[model samples]
Structures are given as C-alpha cells and as structure tokens.
Target chain A: MSQTRDELCWMTISEAAPLIKRRELSPVELTQAHLDRADAVDDRVKAFVTRIDDKAMAAARAAESEIASGHYRGPLHGIPVSLKDFYDTAGVRTTAMSKIFADRVPDEDCTVAASLKGAGTVLLGKVSMSEFGLRGHPTSLFSIPNNPWNLNRSCGQSSSGSAASLAAGVSMGSFGSDSGGSLRNPAHSVGIVGLKPTFGRVSRYGVIPCSHSMDTTGPMARSVADIAALLQATAGHDPHDPYSSKEPVPDYSANLNDGIKGLRIGVPRDYFFNKDGGADPETLDLAEQAIDVLEGLGAQVKEVTIPSVADVRASQGVIMISEAFAYHRQFLRDRHDEYGPVKFRFMLGALYTAEDYLQAQLLRSRICREVAEVFEQVDIIATPSMPRPASVQGDMGHPFSSLGGLNFLVVFNATGHPAISVPCGFTGEGMPVGLQLAARPFQEAALLTAANAYQQSTDWHTKHPVL
Target chain B: MAEHPLPSHDELDARLKGAGIQLSNEELEFFRGAYPEFLDQLKLLYSYDVTGEAYPFDVALFQEPQ
Candidate 1:
C-alpha cells in the first residue's frame, strides 16, 4: 500500500530506514513528500528560517542513487532532518535568528552538521532559534512558530522551530543546542523526545555558544529510538572541539529496547517536587504516575535527594550569563540597539561582578559533587521537564521574572549528565508535560534505554497534535 | 549581601555606561526599572554558602576518563 504524503511526512527515522534500505521507499520520494507537507503547513507553523528546497531535493536524489546501488549509510542515511539556525552551515547564512549575523554565511559546517551530512541525511534547512540561544526574540524574528497543539501557546524556546516542525510533521528529526533547557523545553512543550547527551558527548565545533561551560548539542525527534539513532550518528570525539570527550562512543540504538527492568530509579520526590514553588499540581501528578509505570515494569523506584536544588538554578544563571556576555561582548559593544529586550536583560551579564561569576562556579562544583553521590545510589534520576506546559505565546511576563523556568532541567546541564525528556502525559488543556530522565555522565545508553522503555509502556510519545 | 537587596538604578546605569556600552534613553530607562528584580534573582546565588570550593572547569569533575 502506498502511504499518503501525510503518512510519509510523519514517519520516524527508525520507521523509514528499513524501507529505504529495502528499496520499498525511495529516498527522493520520501524527501519530496516531506517537502510538500512542509510547504503546506510551514506557513501556519513558521518553523523554518530558510528552506533549502533545491539543495534538499538534490541530496535526496543522491541518497536514492546510493541506496539503489546497494549502498546504505545507516538509519539517518536518508532521513529528512534540519538544524537550529545557530549551527553554522557551510555556504548557508547562519544567523542564529538574529539580524546581527543576518548577512553572514559560514564557509564551514559545525562538526555536528557536517557529521549528519556525512551520514547522508538530507539537509532540509536551518530551523529558527532564540538569538544565540538566548537574549533575542522569544520566537524567531522570521516568524513566531505556533504550537501545533494550541496555536496561541509557545512551542518552547531556543529550539522552538525544531519542536514545532517535528510536531507539525514539517521535518522528521532535527538538532538543537541546550545550555539551559533549550532542547528538552521545546521537546516537552511539543510532546516529542529530546536528549541532551553529556556535555562533551557531541562536539560544539561550529554551533554558536550561549555558555561555553554548559552548552550541549543534542537531538530532537518524535521517538526515543529516533533520538537514539541521531545520537548514535553524532556522538564522538572531535579534534576541532577542544571540549569534545575522548570517551568511546557506545551504540545507542542496539540497547534501546533492552528495557528498564531491575534498574534503580530515583524520584527526587521532596526536592524536585517542591523545589522553587514546584510544578503545577497536575504536572506533578503526571510525573508521579509515570514513575508508577516504571515500577510496574520491574524498575525499583526510590526517593533520593541531591542537596542544593535551588542553588542549581541560581548558579546556572550566573555562569551562563557571564559566559554569554564574554561571547557577545563585542556585539553588545558595537550593536547594542540591534538586540531585543530579552537580550538587553541577559547582556546585563556586564553588570555581574567577577567575584559573583566565580562564586557561582564554585557553587556549581559543590552541587556537581553532591549530585554525583546521589547517582552512586541510583541508576537513573527522573523529574518533570518543566513546571508547566507551554505558556501563551509572547507572554514572557516581566523582564526580571524568576529564572524558575530552568528549575527542573538545569541541574543536569550543571552536572554535565546525559538527560532525555519523554512525553509523560498532557495537561487538562491538552498541552504536554515531559518526564525527564538523567543518567550518570556519559551513560546515555542507560538513559535512552530507560526512556525508550517508558515510551513503549506509554502512548504519550505517539500522540500527535492535530493542526 | 542581604537576602534580597535592591540594586540602585543610578548605580546600575552608570555601570553599564562605564563598560562602554551605549543604550538608548528608553533602554536605559527600562534597565533602571528592571534592575531590582534582576538583582533579587541574582542574590539567590549568595545564599548558597559556597565557601572554599573551586570553580567547576571540566566534566571530569564527576567521572573518570574511560
């Protein structure tokens, strides 16, 4: 049976790979189907800053020829994927969704982008992102991408376009940067899977930096298996990225279905559930129910605490803004007026005393130590991805609003642990809430294994928003 | 630092200007209005009691090289 363009567009990379290898689905045909769907829905979703229609088509044709010749790269070989605008693409304008770099086109690709291209994935285009992943428009200035579930609400930040595109079936998979919650935040809001591998798991060679210390490049897709596939293709040591880990990359796809049986799951109940005003009551309930699902699956669930929970947010804020300011000091000095109000607030990094910045780092080191000890007692840790689902579009409250948005997710970034967000359930209003699972540093295999098992037991990841 | 001390607007504006960054009259005014709330959040770091600890520099702080 021939699948319709709609069906073809929504097929996960895991589902499409075998079909392409078997010659039952032509890469060109699949790519054309996604391109057609993107053309139809992107006007409403506004998920792309630049659409590389011709280039994507050409690459699809090349992939189809290679497969037809009995050569297949892998799961991502012919997948139609996109990147956040901040990742520099050779010969493509890498604006980071800001006017400052509007005319700038890079001559080289970021290592992650280049690696995906090397794997024979079709480059659909550059998706929108918050300017430099912080300080600029809440949504892209190109257009605010609307959440597929509720057009009036946000999809989520930094990776807004990537999530919106995946949710609306405009793209099958994509990559996003996270120093804070940029990757999982959007994944949570859009009801998809996003994995922030250990900080050095993926290279940051050409991806723009918001915080050098915490910046992590990660994969976002509709399924845990798909995220595993993407991570498998991208994770490794890179000579160009000094911070890239020398740790041997593990095969994430092989162990995905291994299930979470016999694993120790730490709930972080008191600390995470009540820290910083906690998540909305229903969001907390959904998280608890998700833990119960794991318990039913033979996983041992226990309450654990990582000291200085509140301090994670505060320290992350200071270090991130300080590093971001260091990166953007020249721009802030020369083109102050070009930045949005959000940027003005963040660029106030200039106002932080050097002592404050250093003190925050010291606190980060202490918190990291405390969290490592907690991990020694549990195989994995789980928490809600956010306090609530997507807020109303452009409703970013006051400029000085509490940085509580990062309360649930930033600790992992601080500790450089591998974390993944899987859809746990929906709010009464039908927006999605995410259950975040973090494993020990560089243990993404265990993290993805747990997430994939939880996804298998629940239908949350399979539920899509009707546009 | 006090648990939640307010930053002076005049002092903040002077600091931003002193750093060689120019803000429009409107931008300066907005920063003046928002400085207090921002400081309130920043002050949360001071309450952490992070004495004698070194800054976290590398991911090896948690894991051994494999």
Candidate 2:
C-alpha cells in the first residue's frame, strides 16, 4: 500500500525498514517527508536545536545506493533518527542546551552516534534538552520545547525536544540519556516509549556526563518495536567506556511476540499510591487499569512490597548531585555564571561532606540488594512513570515540587536495572499517562517482550497528538 | 540514627568559597530555598543506621588505571 506524506512521517522504523530494503520506499523520500513535517510543525513543537537536512539527504542517498547495490545492512538502514544534544557528534554542534557548550563542536562522534551511523541510520540533527539535563533555567540559550498534545503543557525536561520531535513525527526515533528519568519522563509526557537500559549496558563514551554512576544512554521512539530496533543497534560494550558491561547483548527484537503469559508482574502500591499530596489520582487510576489489562492478557499480577523504594528518591538526589558536583567543579570555578538553573543545584553538592555522600552511597548499596531480593520473587516491577502527567510549560523547576513524594522511576536508576516506559492511558483532559515496567539487570529482551505485548493489546501507543 | 542538620547560609557560603565558587545574592537566596528540601532528603538517607554495614571506600577502585 502507498503511504501518504503524513503516514510516511509517522511510520515506525519497524514498518519502514523492510520497505526501504525492498526499494519499495526511498530513504530520500522518507527523510524529506520528515524534514517537511518539521518545517511545517516544529514552530509549534519547538523540538530540534539543529536540523542537518543537507547531510541527512546525503546519508539517505548513500543508503539508497547501498541497498540498490545489494549491500543492505540491517533494520536501521535508512531510518531517520534524532540524537539528544548531549551526544557528541563529530562535525555538528553538541550543546547539551548550555551556553558553555553552545558553540562547542566535537572532533569525533560519540560511541552511540558512531554505531547508529554504522547501522546506516540517517542523522536528522541535534535536538534540545534542559540545560545540562538538570532543568531549564530562565537564562538558557535555547527555548524549551512545548508538548505536542497541548501547546500549553510541557514535553518534559532534558529529553524534552526528543520527545516532542517523535510525538509530532518530526523524527521517527531518538537516542537520549537518563541520569534520573531524562528520557522516560519526556516519553511519559509525550505519549511515546523510552527505555533506560541497565546502567552499564550501553556505553556513555563521549556523551556529556551528568551523574557518572547513574547516567545511562537508551532508545526512545513512538512504539516499543521501534525502541527494540534502536536498542539492538546501540546496546553493546565499548572499550572506550571500561565501565560498560562485558555481558553479551541480546537481540532485543528476537522475542517481541513471546507473550507475557504467566509472567509475574509486581505492583508496589503503598509507596506509589500516595494520597495526601503524592501521585495524582488520575495517574494512579490509569496505571492500575493498565495492570488489570496485563492480568487479562494472562500475566500473573500481585501487590509486592519494596519498602526501601520510599528512601531511594532521597538517596538518588543526594548521590546524583554530589557526583555531578565533581564533574562541574572546574566549570563552576571558571564559568560559574554560565551554568543554568543547575547552578544552584550543583552548588548544593558543595555543602555535602564526604561523609554525607558516602553514607548515601552505602544506603544505595543496601537498597540495591533489597530491590534485587524482591526481583527473586517476581519477574517485573510495575509503576506509574511519574506522579502526574505533563506539567504546564514554564512551571517546571530544578528541584521539582513533587520531590518530597515518592518517585517510581528513580529506584531502578539506583539499582542499575533496565526500565521501559510505555504509554498506558490518558487523563480525563486527554493528557497521556505511562506505565513503567522494569526487569532484572540486562534483561532488556524480557522488558521489550512485555512492553511490546502491552502495546499490541492496546491503542494507547497508536494515538497521536493533533498539532 | 542521628539527625543531620542543615547548614546556615554563612556556613554554606563559606563552603562554596572553599570550593572556589561564589554565588550572587539572588543565587544564594535560591540555594537557601532549595537547601532545606535537599537536607530533608538527606535526613531520610542518613536515618538508616549502617553501623556494621561495610561498603567499599577504597579510592583505587575509582582512580585512573595505571
């Protein structure tokens, strides 16, 4: 069947890959459709920081030539993708949405960028993020991206532009990092899918560091199958990042149809279901209904306790900033005013004594063991991706107002487990909510399997925002 | 577990100075507003006593390889 221009822009990489390989679809056409869509709609979504259209067209033509010559590489060949500005691209500006790096271009591509290129994916351009992934400051050099669902609402921070771009069909897929839900937060807000693989599963080589111990690079897209395809191209060990795991990388697309039959799903209700100023009632109800949907699909569901989850948000806050302080120390000394809203937060790290930081790390170790123990009894842990859906743009801040409450996503970051956020349901106002499912370390195949099954059984993922 | 207290603004100012960083008055006020919340989070983490809990404290594990 012939696809229209809008259809071409919205087509998932999974659907487009085969057509491109068969020459039924031209990569140049696909790339141009996206560029046209961005030209038409990005004024409202404000997603891209830089659009390398000429280079993208060149890459597409090269991809077309290779496939016609019978040198097709893989599923990602000729697929257009956005990279979070945090990634260091060789000749393109890699700003991380900060004034300090606004003019800084790299001499070589980061590991993730190089791999996607080797996979034959077309690089659309660098996208916006919160200044240094802390939060958007009033003085940030770039404008904050707006949510496609509602122009007044936020697309979420750090990976905000990546989410807005995909949701608005400006790019089919994106690569973003999550030190503390940077990718998944936007995925949840914009009604898409994002995966934060196990901490060491993907190399962080050349990506701007946020919190070294907790930062992760993962895939984001409009659908789980697309996310699986992107992850398969990017997830592996790199000698450049010694901390990258040496464990074998699984084919994320292998068992996407392997249903979650009898798979145990645990819901930690007490911590996440806060009443007096916890997660919004609408968010919790939709997540609960999502759990019910999985139960109906033959998955065994139970309410399990991971009590330490309450304490993890706090521990992560302390450790993340403390580590970030070390990285930004020189910058603060030389270019203090150049930092964004993160400046205040980064300086907070200075007040912390070495004792305070290590004590929190010690707590982190204990919490990781406790979470691992819970995993022994259950295969997956399910929770709402955020306490609420997207906030109104211009209201989001560095230390979120919800910081005092429980955060469901931060725990996995602390324990270094794989987590996936999939669009679950919507609020009465039509904003989307996300269901986050996490599995044991390096069990991304299992994670993708469950996420894919859920998306297949529901239309939440297929619902797109009308710009 | 003992409660860890939030430092006074002057004390915090001194710490920032020791780190070779100085903030504008507005920035200092912003820190004042956010510090209590951070200290509250720190309190929760420190509340758990790990008196007998041993965690790796060696710097070599994190130091640049030879």
For model 1, the stretches where C-alpha displacement exceeds 4 angstroms are A135-140, A275-278, A402-406, B1-8, B53-66
Pairs that collide, model 2: none
Candidate 1 chain A lDDT trough over 10 residues, lowest sum: A135-144
Q: What is candidate 1's CA lDDT for residue A407?
A: 69
Docking class of 2: acceptable
Candidate 1, residue A427: how far the Cα is off, in Å? 1.3
Please give the distance, in angstroms, between residue A332's alpha carbon in candidate 2 and its true position after superposition.
1.1
Cα displacement (angstroms), candidate 1, residue A10, comes to 1.5
Candidate 1: residue A362 Cα off by (Å): 0.9
* Candidate 2 ranges with C-alpha deviation above 4 Å: A397-403, B52-66
Candidate that scores best on lDDT:
2
